[model samples]
Target: MNSSLQLAVPATRNRAPVGPPFRRQARSRLLRADLLTVIAWASVSFAVALWLADGGAAGFSTPAGSFTALGIVAGLIGMDLVLLMLLLVARTPLIDGAVGHDRALEFHRKLGKPSLYLLLAHGALVAIGYGIAEGLDPVGELVALWLLVPDMWLAIVSIGLFIAVVVTSVVTVRRRLPYEFWYVVHLLTYAAVLTAIPHQFSVGGLFAEGTWQRWYWLAICIATGAALAHYRVLEPLVATARHQLRVSRVVPEAPGVVSIELTGRHLDELAGSGGRFFIWRFLAPGMWWHPHPFSLSTEPVLFDSSGRGRLRITVRNLGHGSAQLTRLKPGTSVAIEGPYGLFSTAARSRDRVVMIGAGIGITPIRALLEGTPFEPGNATVLLRGHSEAELYLGDEVLELCRRRGATLFHLTGPRSAGEHSWLPEPAVHSGHRLASYAPDIADADVYICGPDAWARSVISAARAAGAREEQLHYERFDW
Candidate 1:
């Protein structure tokens, strides 16, 4: 039940800066992110270039010709955008390490509507263009196309699936749906893509057989699918088998929070850099399919040279799946897809560090504190909650701060009345600000994990105190 800091190297008060320079680390990530942007836009440009290379421009001499050409272009970019969205979520290390889970996902979600509109435009514009060419109505042309290929209706079915997937992904719809419901709906996306492919290549003359552009499109599609399979499927299976994880105990930490400790072979391999998280699926009758993304509450504790050890993840009943986990039996098998995201020392851009957490969001911050290097008095941790009991792992975090010689502050009270303040009412009235606690915040890498609104307030206050975008770090735990 108790979490002791791992890597308890004898405390050295005179430790010097040992990590890579802050500027280099920040610049590298920015470059990688820019590279991804360039690649995405270039793909769209290349798709259009392919159309032009094949004499697509001359088709615009007439109104019908113009409509058909534009439709083809829309389909090209729309499909490419869809593929880009898939690739972003495929759990590729290159993407995760560079842009991170939150940023990559933000971009992925933003693409949903535009891609859908483009695909719909492709269908309607082509319908109108071909109808005018044949002296028929748009509805008549659609019916003809539907009849021409018995499977063309699959494309229509795909359109419906796309609509459903995107709608559920909307922030409003998503907030109202159960996690399981939303997850199941998203899985249909693969089916939607598969269904749409047949009509796309068969009837869309742009992808006609023997065309080089068709082969190129197929290659990218296959690549996207392969990335998904390798990272999301095969990699997880390998880790699950290699680690051989099983629940050893589930100990209560508070009224609702608990720490689930697992014993596994080769556990050290799963212990990635600071604050890494894993997607866990307990192999049980009713919980085998649910994915729980949780960070290690403490570092891995190896018992022998064989790499067999124990690891722990703190959990609170945030949803139905998590509530069921409180009853998990010891010896339950665990499947994992791990060590993802850059919420660790890997993202450090400075020597000083400021960590702020509230509620269960404090779990990852605790893990980071245990493993991340910092000189005595150079690090500070601020824990917020309505009461001390709400601080999920406050005692352990306090002990770590003591052992590491870092400053620690516990802020427990009703939130302040000020709309933009993240501090307790008393502190706000006392003229407290983020810089009041961490005077070096502008020079430090700030890590924040809390309720979305509160975290945003902390970030805003830090920025107001001169924290660079590169120095601010936070991960969205909203699933």
Candidate 2:
């Protein structure tokens, strides 16, 4: 194995199962859409089958005829179930910001909805079909359906639990609840999914009717089980195994702005780019419970030029953890884990790049364009700030652009009187002028980092200008 491929920690606490490469398209956003289509088609097919069988068709009487329809229904429902499981596992890691996690979870919930619908239909079809043949009551019908295989009640409960999970996962309810609480509740999905074992073993006669079925279940269980263990258990163990860093300097850029720097051995070993960040400095060492995330505003370089990289974190006081960080001083030991996320420019496929930086979110974009082998001639930097005073590193940015032969477009709010030198062209919201200011809009890969709202705007404009989804990248950082 490659040395770099070595696992940093002994294990992960909770990791989702890996999905197929195709599922990575838009990170599984299409799963829900595709599942819905399958459900719709399957429902129509089942309806037609029921109508034909009720029309006194002799085909319904044959074991082969009934088995074929059941097989079709089971196959459609099973495909959806498999996709949902894949989606739940391969999502991006959650760092300081919740956007990535939220998006993935939303997609996961959507994909499961259609599966739940199919499962309901699966039960109803079985009960109704068997009931009609036997002339049984509703209670007896249900019992008879399970009578085919008594242990299938586990499947019934699994379906019920799946419904419950989907209900709670909805945005309306999920938002009103605490994230950690919701997270724990979400983790229970494994138990609900695992409980389907007995039913699938007994009644999923298509796959589990023979010895091969047992192996199939075993394989699925082991894969999903490993994912759960990695994310929930192994990741935490790995983080805990690492040593912490001591906070060396907290330089105040302004009252609300600050740059916190830290020093530690092996800090240089942390792989990151401009758009990524690490969960940082929580309560104490070994308490890998809740570490905050921050972007590196400057280039990733050896902090002191001695090979041990120093981390320079630029932070804008936003919430509880951020506000408290201002009080921390030199010598305060901190723990940071995760150089996770693929939001950087490196994640893209194109060479021509367009970047928009709002507030301190400029850190990662700046780091990438400056530290990496990126040339300015192929990129455009659109820096937005509240005012000239709020804008940091204007001179440094200009120098970097000059070195790379890149164009720098500075957009700032209106001033009271005199003209400003930093405001290169008059700030205009007009679409034409905005496009003209950044000529790279036509073909360059667009990267937006900073406030979510601003990033959203840049993405809208980029997409509107015909930029492909593959060329769009965003790093959401709190100001």
Model 1 accuracy (lDDT, Cα): 0.86
lDDT string, candidate 1, 1-479, tens digits: 11112223245555545656766887888899899899989998998888788778997999998888888888888888998999989989999989888888889999999999999998898888999999989899989988886677898788889999999999999999988899999998888888888877777476777777888889998999999999999999999999999999999999878999999999777665558788999999999998898889999999998999999999999777889999999999999997888888888888889999989999999999988878777788988888888888888998888788778888877788664468887777777788888899999999999889899898999999999998989977874
Q: What lDDT tens digits, residue by residue, belong to model 2 across residues 383-472?
A: 777665555665566677666656776677642122222222243322233366555576666777766655676677677677777567
Model 1: CA > 4 A from native: 1-17
The residue-level lDDT of candidate 1 at 479 comes to: 44
Clashes of 1: 0
The deviation in Å at residue 384 for candidate 1 is 0.6
Off by over 4 Å in 2: 1-88, 91-109, 130-157, 202-210, 243-258, 279-288, 291-294, 299-307, 321-337, 389-405, 414-426, 429-432, 476-479
